[model samples]
Target: MKAKYRRRFGFKATKNGPALQSTIVKACASVVIPALNEAKRIQEVVAYALADPATDEVIVIDDSSIDNTAMLARQAGALVVTSSMLGKGTSMRDGAAAAIQDIVVYLDGDLANLRPGIITSLCLPLLNNEADFVKARFGRGGGRVTELTAKPMLKVFFPELAHLAQPLGGIIAARRSLLQALTFEDGYGVDVGLLVDAYLAGAQLAEVDIGSLEHDSQPLHDLTFMANEVSRVIFNRAKLAGRLHVEQVIAMYESQRQVTAGIDYVLSLRKGRRCLLLLDMDGTITPSRFALELARITGNEAALMQMLDTPHDDAITRSERIAGLFRFVHKQQFEQTARSLEIRPGVVELVNQARRAGFMVGVVSDSYFIAAEIIRRRIFADFALAHTLTFEGDVCNGQLQINSAFLPDDDDADAPICKSNVLRCVLADKTPPPVELIWAVGDNLNDLEMLRLADNAFVIDPKSPKLSEEPGIAVINAFTDLVKLLGHEANLVDQK
Candidate 1:
């Protein structure tokens, strides 16, 4: 289905027109600010944009601010556009219309610690033809949730965007050619919507550190609204990109929300009992495509497997080989392909059952965090350990950076994460005491360590190519058979 709202301000195409084309050969650069009640900081924001020589024009769209934001922006030599519609999206649209330049830079007006260099840092990539889009990152900001939540969420579900550091940040720069083609959501979701849309439209993107900036931290009370808006933006983009099926979208939403709500409730209960449920990504929750898919997209799949599959006695050499494979696949294509993967049947039911059984579910995988996050969101797993991707703007640096907590130390013997390490961590974190019953599941050789660590382990749909063949691990063809194995009632599963 087509998006309900369309871009009205930018270049419009006529019916049966011979493709829309740009009028300007060289796109001028404009800085667009969507301001609300930023009377104190609007002028500083305008000044920063104007100070950059590359920025030809500054357009500030006031979203019905009761404060003197428009007046302040005008005083700073910016062209002011007032919008009665009252939203960041509407303001952006108005600003885009007033812009004479083909390259637009959007900045939040409430930054108290705004730096002049940020303007140049954000716009330079787009101006020099290095990237089609740029996202700004600050040293001191309330973007921890964004880094931990949104970015990882995008990486897993929208792998094409796995490289974007601040997907929901208020600051961005994009070429008019790409900006005009996007449908912006008119709420808290606008930033994320733009990022996903631009990436899906095949724009080369990157993020740059603007040093540091301080802003009002969102209170814990606002998380629900943020999550809803973020989810809406992600789901809509996924639907548009054909990564998400319409019917399954509803189920996906329900399953995710339920898992999150369940976790919240479980944490609140303060139960002393602690149980751990370790999950595998590739084939257990979703279909395994990392090897073949990476090969097909990057043309380096064989080389990647050789590095991973070969008997590497040297840890450093093994790490280098894996990193080399990631370097070959462009972040955008990797994400797009990952999103197209399908989840296993009855996976949600199994997760809900596990949650009800008082198991503290978490994922331990050698895969990228973005890939692990997809499983986490799909099943509402509490935590995940995976590889990290370094991003400058929207594009990746092609470096495979692992999370420090998951990294192996010099003294550690059994590779970085022997399933025993994951088990020990979970067991140690239990509030009262670790539960006697612990269950782990997997389908690959990577899971062998964890499976051995668990009190009981289930190997689901194992491929013949895998190396390990542990005797204690019960083989299950389908996840639906889990309830019977665990002696649970089928009706107890939370379908919602």
Candidate 2:
């Protein structure tokens, strides 16, 4: 998807470029390039920044480069400063501190092919006061780590940021005041973490089309380390914002480490044609039941139980009423609690096994998007579908937006949100691979339609005694049993 700017306070563009240029002169920008052993490309990048009319100064943070990167930057007309051999985050902090201009523009030193006028373009939004922070989006497609790790997590937790084509892009410009107040995450996450912090702090954020950017891609093995640090920063921010507790952050970090380590193992295995692997997020994927933490935190277990028992006539109504219970609960509290839940022991193994066996593993849940996507990344699901909750900064505003993909077909106002429709739509779209059979797994009444629609369905809800004897539904005590089921099916397909 193309990156769209998320402007607050209804900013409108004026046809007064001359006037805006005047403002740029007043608010001088210092272009800061953080470098590490970029002797070949630093000179050109530095020259481009220096030539921009809006820029009053240029600073390069040489991160303990053993080469002549610092000397080259100085020769190219930039103030060079040395940073400790720590990480990019440290360089960013040090560079910002050394800047004397009102705005700071951060550009990667290794950009081999940078378009002219890109620096001036990135500074316009800040000069006119339309944005306090601006991220540059270029024409090149983002990397695999972006598509695989960063995008999914952003879609789930920070939906407002989903439109950004390159959330991890190092080309960004922000007000010096905002930059000073923000925390810089070390390594690969510095870019994404800055964007998230800016958005959550209610800063006017914009992304400019900076034409095309060309830079060298990292080696395959190094990408795993990059993904780990990036994922850690994403979760670490949530913890600092009170969206996740300390234990939850540690658990998430450890799980992602396993994900990185197992990347080679999963890719080396031969994958097959498409089959279906549908999963539910709340209790089926995790240990505890749904919304149990919310009730416990607010001391409203009785209220929660009443809402569950007192069914509203329609899905919208039911969702709206349930959301009302969280109005008093801060979004941070809700998110932190959700992150604290641990996944089932064999869940990740099952997902990896399914993928290696040519199954299209997807999470289809009636739960909110944040929880669904977070769990999806932990287990490495291909895609996910879930409802979105609205939030202002760090607080939920008691409003819920149901996913239009799963909305009921008819005009029955009282009808519930049906996952069966979404499942059918997904199956229809998988035409090339042609899904031979579907396997649905869930733990509650909300999954009834989906379970019935699947070729094979399993009820893993230990608490639901009523579903134990349901016809055509298999009841399983442990998720590890799916390995046997898949193995048996593989034999049948082989015979065919």
Candidate 3:
């Protein structure tokens, strides 16, 4: 009966039964290429792969490429596997399985600028046990996503990987031990997914410069899709590692609340006592909710939320994240849409009233000076402390040149214009030493530390639900409520 079934199915029966066996042959190294319509570039890439002395074999998986990619790769001395399904992730998995070497190197087919050195650079770290995985970095041709998405995400969630630049670069090499243990996602996010997986798997990773290599640039419409996939990979890895706990999530939310409440209390007391009031534009007076709105408009809401969920530690530089934010804004042209943003109601009136009360009212927001200047002039603010954006003629240079004076030095001083430091400066320059009271209000996690240092805290309409749990924090639904709480007539004109 078994023989008859085998004959009917066109299967050859062997003496060792038909069960799948663990094929674990080990060679020096194997190069795997997941090619899709790369007939013209496959040969050159294969030649580059073969040039490395450590490379014992090359495997190319053609995922139903419309071109003669498989034929070309086979002709170039590579073992080709034809995959019925498409996707770089699936092709990579197929190629990895076919690799007979202890070390596996994966390279993209479109690397027209391919050189022999890249293979060595990718494989050396893995071969020497210095790293279980190696990522490639090109001097001139790296993707903007590396600087904007991967680096910032790493800086926030996994600070150890922050120093490993180009965390999302496609070219990588790893030991077979590590490759077999990972779960590769099928999409443009495969590279980032792999890095996060490796990190969570306790594999040491390093980045190596592979010289300059050119590839196609993705369109703006593709960014949201790419960001979503990348975020999925990151969140999945974090979840698998038990890093995203409910308690920690709650704490982050509460911190945001405490800070917001603290800011409100300080501002309210100052308004009552006729003291000068200064507020930071971003995350202070005006909420950072505009970014969320922009993300919603651009269809990147999921990606933005994922980023907001990541736990940021001190190791991550705020400057780098700020740079990423600027890039994100420029890419979406969100600044042009600022006129439509909704401010916390009564903020303008609060500024005006404070000024009328003999207070030097102004803003100290981290928003671009140009944008803040518009708000400053409109509200008749006395001064604005903001970063000046660098521009070439009329166009933006996409780089933020923060004034050096704002950066904190090593003399037991914090950032020169940080919320607490700014408040201190205002007190020293304008008010008597040991002023009656210092009040501050805000609405995000970033404001928590500064709020804790203040005499009173007030939480406003908060984005995070955790704020409700903060001890001794006064919560208000509207800015007018704050005015009433401060023993002043409600400013109904600015009410939303």
List, residue by residue over 111-152, the lDDT tens digit for candidate 3.
Answer: 775543456566667767799898887642234455445554
Runs in model 3 lying further than 4 Å from the true structure: 1-27, 140-142, 245-496
Task: Itemize residue pairs with steric clashes in candidate 2.
Answer: 243-336
lDDT of 1 by residue, 1-496 (tens): 0011012122234442111222221225788889889998888677766655456778888887898988888888888888758788888877777778878888888776554445556666776789998888754222434543565456556777766556788888888778788887798888888888777788898888876566655777786688778877887777777777654444343233223222223332324435556777777777775545666677776787677677844644575456666653555665676676688888778778777776667766666665566657767776666655544333445666544444444577566644456565445443334355678888877677778877778888786544235678888878887865553422222221
Pick the winner on lDDT between candidates 1 and 3. 1
lDDT of each: 0.65, 0.73, 0.60
What local lDDT does model 2 show for residue 121?
80
Candidate closest to the true structure, highest lDDT: 2
Predicted candidate 2 versus true structure: per-residue lDDT over 321-403, tens digit per residue: 77777775676676677677788878888888887776768777777765666677878887667766655544666777676
Error of 1 at 442 (Å): 31
Report the Cα lDDT for candidate 2.
Answer: 0.73
Q: What value does the lDDT take at residue 6 in candidate 2? A: 8
Measure candidate 3: CA RMSD.
22.2
TM-scores for all predictions: 0.48, 0.48, 0.48
